[model samples]
Target chain A: MEDQLTLGGRNFSSRLLTGTGKFASHTLIGPMLAASGSQIITVALRRVDPKAPPQDNILSHIPDTVTLLPNTSGARTAREAVRIAHIAREAGCGDFVKIEVITDMQYLLPDNHETLKATEILAKEGCIVLPYVMPDITISHQLYDAGAAAVMPLGSPIGSNLGLEMKPMIQRIIETSRLPVIVDAGTALWSNHQPVCPPLYLRLLFQPLHLLRVQCGYRLSQNPADHE
Target chain B: MNININGEAVETSTPDILSLVRARNLDPSSLVVEHNHTIIQQAAWADTLLQQGDTIELLSFVGGG
Candidate 1:
């Protein structure tokens, strides 16, 4: 497994990047990370109570082998995202940040306009900015120009788990963009062991999540690591 | 004196950020401080004294995505 996915000047053999949310507990994250073999894990920043003791903190659970990618999930605008990035780095979380700006409460879609603004600001400040945007080629190019590390296009709305619904647009972006196209959201599975997302589960599941994401019509990109 | 820390009112007599960190049993190296909307660097924590009616926000990365 010499094949590696490089981001922010670092190489990751395990292309999979898993999330800390939607899990049973912080303890489960370790085994799930082991099962998935993800080199990178994403977490969100929240305001903690001053009186509460930091016993089961997420940082204490994550293994030191994996890199921490703190996402700006609560941000509604670019300015707020930038602020969070600074706070994350200052908190010793390092420079890796996932810029997620969502204003649409109904669909929970990523706002590309504000995302681009935040990317430009944070990337300039030496943060590896990975933005989650709608599957649009033009906006992907803009984000690349804004110094983004990778263009993370959503397969569907956040938490929808309707994997790669925007197949045509995501394929177009993957094919045309010079930067790496990361399929970020819309990956969902059921607790009952039922296959809620059919296309992805059927077509691609044996490999890592970052590799072999669904493009138009269950097609696998020629090179799983390089392409979307 | 009373000060706001992470939105909770705390009555502490800690003279500076170092003392405050010690008082709260917080690892001085593990947390970042935003005192009144400005990020106070770790090096300045000792000199950055706490004051009455001052607002201090301590933020740390947690486990959620």
Candidate 2:
């Protein structure tokens, strides 16, 4: 929790980021957000029903306390992702865009070339681009050079529940990256396998932090201000 | 028509800066100015001008971030 995660000029106090989707109810999201201690909340842009009937805005349920990260979840190409980013901005999400270039349906791996291209163009257009990419150190460096504020590598394919299979690559990326390394997708929990933590160059997505705190058997104070 | 340039009166023998700039073959990027306290963009600066005491300020691009 003490790790510093800086993106787009704003320094976030917590590394844990939660998604606004998959919650049972909108009411449950609030408590989950509080418990997760996430400063950023990722929202799948494709899920937002902009053309919904007056009484049924799915996005209306999301509380304002969490900063929304509109992700291009369903986009298979850079062009589609860029178009979705424009749509998100028009919907008042502004230039804060998460570039998700998952082309493969089975593995959900990011297309490094398309992701790099999208990142360069989006960043030049003043969009704060956070790209979800593969755990390749070279690709991560290329994305960083392309002006991505953060690079999110998947631990495994989305929803497979496989945790940190690319530990060696993740370790190398964390060591050399100038941008934040956000481990996204997969798994229910981080492995309690290592005591000598790899010197993290700013990790994001708080599930790991929470697990660490719990592992230490330290009870965090309930005061919101103290933690926030 | 009469035009003002930095509080000084001048008459451009044309309607606007665009026509004048075009006629003179001037590059719009070489100059910077402000219209009524708001900075006129480089692309639009050549078309902007003072209309009878309309406030105008001239600015030059400097090398720095």
Candidate 3:
């Protein structure tokens, strides 16, 4: 077994980190979390509808033991990212934040310059920052100095589901990184030949949760775990 | 007076930030406030007095990845 992965002074037995983005139902989150055994899950902060009723959202579905990693997904610049980070922390999501600064709307690639700037600022302000980048080694080194708890490099474009197109670059980053290299996207283990489809792949890949020792979502029409 | 909230200009006679939240039917405990781009703690909502042209941002956590 891969030993426990440590980040932000906390030891996580399940290296697999999951995201709650494309689930068909928010109510399914708890059961999905139970099945995957992910220690850390990501959530996005947003403006509450003042006119609407306060319906229970994703926060209510996730287990209390799982760490809530609020991501700055919509931030397009370092300043905006810094602003969101402050809001997330002040809202009691704690100091753990995922810095995702993406300006290119086409590919949705993470802007390395803006992310680096945000990481420097948030880290100094006592946040356990995890930056999602386009897989660059020099930037990873810089983020480590900025007190980043770990560096999350994309396996492919965000939500592309292309599956590790950047594997070579990601390997270089993992090899050179001073901090833990948690592959955020495109880490799913599936090929077209398998009887298990993408949804099943999404669910079961994380079920071998501890295999990565420091790692590991998207959408699907059906709940993937139904196959088992 | 007109105060900008979440980028929409609105006229309100609310005395303090807490009242604005209450007037909007928001649960103060469930909302996170940013006044003029600076975070205002929930405990300080009563202490945070609003003024004309103040920018108030109300945020809450949602499902994301």
Model 2 docking category: incorrect
Cand 2, B chain, TM: 0.51
Per-prediction TM-score, chain B alone: 0.89, 0.51, 0.94
**Considering only chain B, what TM-score does candidate 3 achieve?**
0.94
Q: Rank the candidates by DockQ, best first.
A: 3, 1, 2
User: How many angstroms is residue A27 displaced in model 1 relative to the true structure, after the best TM-score fit?
Assistant: 2.0
Please state how well chain A of candidate 2 matches the true chain A, as a TM-score. 0.77
Error of 1 at A37 (Å): 1.3
Deviation (Å) of A28 in candidate 1 = 2.1
- Give residue A114's lDDT in candidate 1 (0 to 100): 98
> Mind giving the per-residue lDDT tens digits that candidate 2 earns over A103-183?
788887778788888888899898999888787889888988888988887766665545557657766777777778776
Local accuracy of candidate 2 as per-residue lDDT tens digits, B1-65: 56555556656665555665455443444333445655556567556753654554442211100
* Candidate 3, residue A152: lDDT: 85
Clashing pairs in 1: A44-B64
Which candidate should be chosen as best, given TM-score against the real structure? Answer: 3
Using Cα atoms, each model's DockQ against the true complex is 0.44, 0.01, 0.61
Of candidate 1 chain B, the 10-residue stretch with the lowest lDDT total is B23-32
